[model samples]
Structures are given as structure tokens and as C-alpha cells.
Target: MADDTGNLELEAFRAEARAWLEANFPPALKGKGGLAMAEITFQDADLATWRRAIGEKGWATPTWPKEYGGGGLSRAQARVLQQEMGRIGAFNPLMFGMGVTMIGPTILDYGTEAQKQQHIPPIVRGEVQWCVGYSEPNAGSDLASLQMRCEDAGDHWQINGSKIWTSGAQYSDWCGALVRTDPTAKKHDGISFILIDMHQPAIETRPIKLIAGASPFCETFFTDATAPKDAILGELNRGWTVGKRLLQHERASQTGDRGPGGGGSAVALADLAKRYAGADAAGRIADPDLRTRVIRQQMDAKVHGLTLARAAAEAKEGASNAASVLKNSATHVAQTRAELMLEIMGHQGLGWDGEDFTREELEAVRGWLSGKAMSIYGGSFEIQNNIISKRILGLPDSTGST
Candidate 1:
């Protein structure tokens, strides 16, 4: 009886969601969710309007609390909202921001009431862009070895040093960073997480263009930058813990926690193969080997989706170690698809730009090129393997420490 009642209530919510989305989601933006970028999120009038609409409705973060300007929907209802949004090809305009994916959730996890009041509302409203400061030139995977320094000032905190591969720093209004707060302590123990304003003169960002063309990554230097004393997240010298927690959030978002249909309008593998490689008499891919490989790729994708769904259902209010496992899996599925796509497109996939190829084909070439970084970013494949073995499987670290 309870289950039946819940189902009835969810059905009512679904109907309500359908109506509300139909009225509020702009027709011009339908099926165009993949087109919005944080740098230009507000550049187009229609896209800005769509962002404001969804942010205000708080459906951009459906399962978050209402107090923080979130929709306050239950997990079940959030799923329903996603289903309705997917029904019309509507995407979360704000999901592209690292604020929503990594920093905001970490704030909610470890922030004080005052900090939450200061930050989460702006995030939920899509009012600011955020970047992360973790990787240093010397400390890519050994992030704990990062030397970016933070110190106590009489009235404020002083920040110095730099971050490399700081994604979206040029456009970000703020940064959530891991810094060395206690230099005398162990590398992992001396870290502190803090929030910094990007607008100050002490900070400068230089963009790093990748082979894929325009990129969001930058080398961000902080020369005696400043933050309020309260800007430190969690306890002083306890940021390694906080930073790991944030990584879990990062991995989860990378694994598609951005809600249903949040992956954008990416063409399916089978469809792409059928279109590019031609088809057999029975409608399989024309090439027998390609057909089998495509089927396997599709199956792998399906397994990742199912695993992700199950994990999401079982996950609690913050992230967990399981995210590490799923992140690698997601990377595998995505990279495999990109490889298959390029092979199926043959020389046609080699298009850089010209009238000879379609926009999707051009993007496919770039995607295939950029896809190589998947195993490197968001923690490397080896890093994730270490995490899985040590944390999940209770294996020992290289130092013979558990």
C-alpha cells in the first residue's frame, strides 16, 4: 500500500514536471543542451534566459535542499524530473560548471553555516563560475606534493604559488583550492582547502590550448593573493581529507551523476557505426568485425550505465570510494566509443575543418583526439587503480603501508 501510494504521488509529480518544463524550457534551446558553455553561458540572450529559468526553478540541482536555493526534491522525484527533462531533450544548463559538480557539493559536505550561506546559493542560482586549484607543474598525480602555499595574515589569509591545468580559471569568478598551509608537516598532512576570489590583482591566468583547439585549462599564478580568514574549508591542515572528499565528487560527476539525460545529445555508437560503416542485409554493421566490436562497445556502455544507476541509488548524501571505480569505467566506455567512431569514419573522421565534412564529423575528430586525456585527467588510470586497490579492496600502499 505504501509503495503504491508513493508511485501515485511520483506519477503526479511527473505530470507536474512535464507541464512546468513545457512552459518554461525555451523552444530554441530544445535538444541544444550540449551547445552551452560556461564561458558563454550568459553570452546568448536565449541561453541566459534558459539558465535563469532552470536555476530559479532549482531543477538544475533537483535533489539539493531548498534552503540553498535548490529544488529540495527527493531522490525519486529528482529522477522523475530528469525523466521529464529527458523526454523533451532538456539538459541542465549549469551542470557544465565545476561549481555544481565538485566544489558546491564539497561545501555542503564540510562548510560552516556561514560559508554555506555565502556560497551554495550563488552556485544553485548559476550566478558564478568556479575553477579548481589542485594540480601543480610538479605535482600532477602526486597532488599531495603540491607546493601552492597559504599562510595566516593578521586580518586575512595570504596565498602564493600556482596551479597548472586549472580548468576554466579564465572565466571563473572563484576557485576552490588545495594549498600547503603547514609546510612543516607531512606532504599529505600539511594541506588545506580554501576558496579564493579570481578577480583580485594577485592572480593571473594563462590559457593552455590543447590539440583539440580552444580549451578551458590554464596555468593560474597567485602572487600574495588573499582570502578572508574564514575562507579556509574544513579544518586547517586537514584539507587532504577534504580534498579527497572533493575528488570523490569529481569522479562521481565524471561518472554521469549530472542527472538523467545530462550527457547531452551525443550520437549513439550503433547509430554512428550504421551511418558511417554501412549496414548488412540483416541491418548489422556491414563489416563483421566492426559489427561484433560495435555490439561489444554498446554492451559495455549499457553495463556502465546500469552500474552507475545502481551506484547512484545506493550512494548517500556525499560521494564515496565507489566513484573511483566508476570513473575508470566511464573513461573506458567513452574512450572506446571515440576510438570506434574514428575507425568507422575512416579518412572521413580525419576532418579538421572544411566544407567536405559535417560539423558532427569535425567534432568527432576533435573528440577522438581529446579523448586521449580521459585516462590522465580527473586522476589517472593508474591513480584510480591505486585508489580502488587500497581503499576498496583494502590493499597496501607502495610504502608497505595500508
Candidate 2:
């Protein structure tokens, strides 16, 4: 009886949320939200209006602090908002940038009062974009070995180094970068986390083309670029701690739990298989083995999602490296789905672009290619395994033993 009552309350809240969204959300922009920058059509007036409305409402950063222009929503309420948005095919007006998913959460965790007031509001409003600078040519998975240098320059800092695989670097307004501030200290101890403006002459970005023909990544160069002295986040020379926290947030973002953005919009694998591979009587997928695989994948995805919810429920303070577990699981689920998509579509999924294949088919091929990199980015699968081993499992260092 109590569970039934609680569910009734939730339904009432959902109805209210649905009504508000219908009245306020622009009709022309339905299903057009949550697009990556590369996928967005800039000329659409409706998109702009919707962005403003959602940003002003503070629902884009729903779980962030209300004082920082966030929605002040509980996790349950946030889920309701997501459900309501998905029901009407309403997309999140905020673009899929590092600001909301990665940087904003980290800043909220570590930023000073002034930094929070200055940065979080703009981010919550979707007024700016951010990129992370952690990886370098010599330091990808082993991030503590990074050599980007930031020197004291009185009122500001002079930064010089290059960062590789910086997603959306070419168009970012600011960067949350990890740099070496003390050469004499140990590799991990010498680092600092700082924010640097990207619109300066000393900063340059070159996009890296990928097999998918679309790229969100760039190689970013900093030739004595300037950052205000006050831009340091957390403590100086303790950025390894700060950087790890940021990565925890990042891995959380990549886990793809259906948040305010309603990220899981891809066609169901079973439905696709039925459409492409034909269906048996009673509307079941014809191939017994394929149907079993789909069921297994679906079960795994649900368990992964439930684990995420439990983790979210447990973490009142902040995320830990346990996010690494979710990151690996999400990578597996996403990559598996992409592979299954191709298998279902057969030759049709191989099409790139033309009238020859459906839009869904072309997207599947590209998605499969792009999904391959998920295990590599945000720290590789092997890196996550190391973390899970050393940190979570309390395993002794293998190198120390030999």
C-alpha cells in the first residue's frame, strides 16, 4: 500500500512536469535537442529559444546547486524530468559538451566560492563550453607523466605544452588543464589544475580526422599561453588528486545513465533485429540464438543501470574510482550494442552516406566505428583495470613484487 501511494505521488509529479514542459518547450525543437556540436544545425531559431528557456529554468544542470542557477532537483525529481522529456521526444537543449558533464561537476566538487559563483552559473546556463587537457603525446594512460609546463608570471601564469585527444578543443572557450608547476617535485606531486582561456594567440588547435569522417577531437598547443593566477583549482601541487576527481566525474558522465539528456534514444536491438532479420510467430525474433543474445545484452544493460543507481544513491559526498567499474561496463554495453546493430543490419549497415541506405543504417556503421574508441578514451580499459585492481581490490603493485 505504501509503495502504491508513493508511485501515485510520482505519477502526479510526472503529470505536472509534463504539462509545464509542453507549455514552455518550443514545439519546433522537439527531438532536436541533445545533439553534439558537430551534429547541430546552427541556424535554427527554435533551438536557440529552447536553449535559453531550459538554461534559464536551470534544468540542464538539474542536480547542481540552485544558487548556481541549477534546478535544485533531487535525484528522483531529475529522473522524472528525464522521463517527461523522453515521453514527448523533447531533447535536452544543452549540447553534449564537457562543461555540463565533466568540468561543471568537478568544479562544484573542488572550486572555491568565487570560482563556483563565476564559472558554475555560465556553465549551468549553457553559455560556455569547456575542454579537458590531461593527455599528451608522451602521457596518455599514464597521465601523471604529463610534461605541460605552467610557470609563475606574477599576476598570471605562462603555460607551454601540447595536449592530444582534446575533444572539441577547436571550438572550446576555456580549458580545465593539468600542468606541471614544480619541476623538482615527483611527477605526480608537481602537477596543478588550472583553467586557461582558449581564445588567445598563443593557443592553437588542429582537428584530428577519424575513420568515421566526423571528429570531436583536436590536438591543442599552448605556446606560452596566459592564465590568470587565480585560475588554480584545489591546492597547488596537489592536482593529481584534483585531476583524478575530475576523471571520476568524467567517467561517470561516460557511463551513459539516462540523465536529463535522455541519452538512450537508439532503436532497441530486438526491434531492429525483427525489422532486418525477420520475426517469428507471436512477434518474437526468428533466430533463436540472436534472440538469446539480445536478451542477455538487455539483462546486462539493466543490471549495469541498476548498479549505477545504487552507486548514485550511496554517494552523498562524491564519486570515487569505483566509477572505473561503471566506465568499463558502459564501454562493453555500448560496443556490444554497436556490433549487434551491424550484425542485424547485415550489408545495409555498412553504408556510409547516400540514398542507398536508411539514416539509421548509416548511423549504425558510424556508431560502431566511433564506439570502438570508448574503451580507449577517459583512461583506457587496461588503465581502469589497473585502478580497479590497485584501488578497489586492494591488490599490491605487480611491479613492486618483482
Candidate 3:
């Protein structure tokens, strides 16, 4: 799949990629498999092998610059690689998290050449994991109001604050966090984006349990957690701008638009429907009204996916604001799919946990509950609507009902 002479057609690249993945990626790893297949775990050795293969080829981050240990492929070629990988049912080598979704993009766009050279390669090779430290207990939607203080010293900064809803922090090696660097300035003015070493003795993470019984998120406490002077991501006291851009990338990834491979809720939903609602179950499609709704949702998902592709293509050509629309559409699609899945399962979807419940039933309930956050996180639905109106439609801000 290497574009050696810079003239290889996408079709040829895809053919080569498909053959390579088929030959290498285990068949069991492909597609949405059954319960047993889903239960199959990839250990450290397995993950290392996959990461090394993809990292060596720079295929893990194909569109990234070659100097940063990326494939240096064009967007078109990257799409070909994704399609071929999907064709062979190859799971993405890099695990999804704040690292790939948020921090990596921020570093790429705003970091100095030296910072990029140091950070991007390790991330591309899965050598480290990262988390975002944005949402404090009091400052989620109003992120500018964060109170995490990073006091300046001679060589480093002393960070002290609590960050809530930090996903994967317990497992992360580092965090791309927002801290108040200048208390004298306005809420948005004093903040700086800094990379915190999670392994520090002063840093602590306590898992926060959710309604779904999973605690992937954490409450992180930084008590004089020190970050080197070089750890600052962008201009000092101008981190909000960099942070917002990173959030944009984070939102895009959550919506399944940005990142190494495109995101989709359809495959997961369809699999659930097939398993819980059965191939031709009455609840699945017998009701014309429900069937119409499902078809509409499926069409909408496809449209959203295509819209994301279009936006990404435009971005590659230097367009701005395409991400806003794509993010809005993708989040809505995901929320709808979650609701539809629950509806399709009906009474069976109500179970929380028990041996009596099948895996499909458990998934339906957990997914339905978790899906509620889709619109809220990554900028709330109201915020997205505001962006669309002001930025896309050129409408004035209004409190009045449409």
C-alpha cells in the first residue's frame, strides 16, 4: 500500500491492502462476530504485534506526515486503506481514547515541530495512552470556567485541582489537561493546555461508577502535580483556543468522523438487532410503523456517514466549518440508533444484569442508558444547534421558538 512513486492509483493500493490484511489479520477478528468472538481478548503480546506491524508500515496513522512516523498517504489513499481493512475484518490496532481522539490532533495542529516529533511517534505506535482533563466538577459546559491551577515556578508548573468525568485516566500514562495559568486574567484568558504525566506521585485517579455498572471514567486529583515547562502544548495563557480546537477534534471523533478510521454506530446496532430481535422477529420488522422508522434511521445513518466523508474530503482541500455540520449529524444519528435499538428489543431491553439476561439483552439496556450522553458530551445538542444556526445558516442568536 506504500505510494512509492507517488502515482499509484487508489484501486491498486486497495487491492494490495486487502490482500495483506486477509493474509495477516485473523478471520476471527473480522466483522461483528458472535458473543464468543466478541469475548475474544487481545493480550499485550497480541496488541504489540498488531501495533508494530501497523506502526512500521505507518498505516496506523496513514494520513499523518511520514516524518512523524505516519504513512504519508493522501486522504483518498487513506480511505482505500480503511475500506480494505474493513473488507478483511481487521480490528484497528490502536485502542480508541483521548490519546488518538483529542490529544494527538491537538499536538499535530498546534504543537511545535519538536513536540510533534517527540509525541506523535509514540502515540502512533501505541507506546502510551492519554486522557483529557477538561470537565471539572463545576466546569463542563462552561469549560472556560475551569479552576485547575497551574502555578508557575522556575522550571516547571505546580498543578492542583480535581477533574471529573476523565475517561480512561486510570489506564492512561499521560493527560492533555487544561489548567489556569494566570489567575488575574478573565476566565478564558488565563488557561493553558498542558500535558500532565499521570504517573507522578502527586496525581491520583479514582474510578467513578456509572449507572451501567462500568467505571471507564475517573475523578482525577492533581495535588501539586508538576509538569515540565516544555509540557505546555500551545502558547501560554492561550490554551483555551488550542483546547477548543482539540475539543472540536474530540467531538468529531466521538461522532465517528475524525480519527484514523471512520466511526459508525450502524454495524453495532444492526448486530444487536440481529441478535436480540432475531433475523425476522416480529418486533424487528413486522410493524410497518416501526419498520418505517428503522428504515428512516438506516437511511439517515448512511447520509450522516456520507456527509462526514464529504466534510473530511473538504477539510483535506482546506475548507473550514464542515466539521460542525458533520459532528451535529453524526451525534444525532448515534442517539437515534440507540433509542431505536431499545425500542426494537422492547421488554427484553429493560434488564440491567443477571444470569437470566442474554448478552444481547444486557447490551441493549447498557447501550440505551449510555447513549443518553451522546448529545450532551462533545458539545451538547443545544450548542450544536447554535453553531449550525450562527455559523452555517447565518442566523442571529434567538431565544424565541421556531
Top candidate by lDDT: 1
TM-score per candidate, in order?
Answer: 0.95, 0.93, 0.87
- Rank the candidate models, highest lDDT first: 1, 2, 3
Off by over 4 Å in 3: 1-8, 32-48, 258-284, 316-319, 354-356, 399-402
Per-prediction tally of clashes: 0, 0, 0
- The per-residue C-alpha lDDT of model 1 at residue 143 equals 87
Query: What is the lDDT for 49 in model 3?
Result: 60
**Ranking 1 against 3 by TM-score, winner:** 1
Query: Regarding TM-score, does 1 or 2 come out ahead?
Result: 1
Candidate 1, residue 87: the lDDT equals 82
Which regions of candidate 1 are displaced past 4 Å?
38-42, 316-319, 396-402
Model 3 lDDT, full chain set: 0.75
Predicted candidate 2 versus true structure: per-residue lDDT over 1-402, tens digit per residue: 998987898888788788889987776655544343433335566767777788899888887889999999877888999888877777765637788888888898889999999999999888888999989999987889999999999999999999999998887899999999998998789899999989999999999999988768899999989999889999999999999888887888788663675543446899999999999988999999999999999998998889888888787765577689999999999899888989999999999989999877877798899889998998899989999999899999897756
Q: Model 3 shows how many backbone clashes? A: 0
The 10 consecutive residues of candidate 1 with the worst lDDT sum are 33-42
Model 2, residue pairs in steric clash: none
Residue-by-residue lDDT tens digits, candidate 1, 215-299: 6799999999999999999999999999998888888888866774483544777778889888889987788898899889889
Candidate 1 clash pair list: none
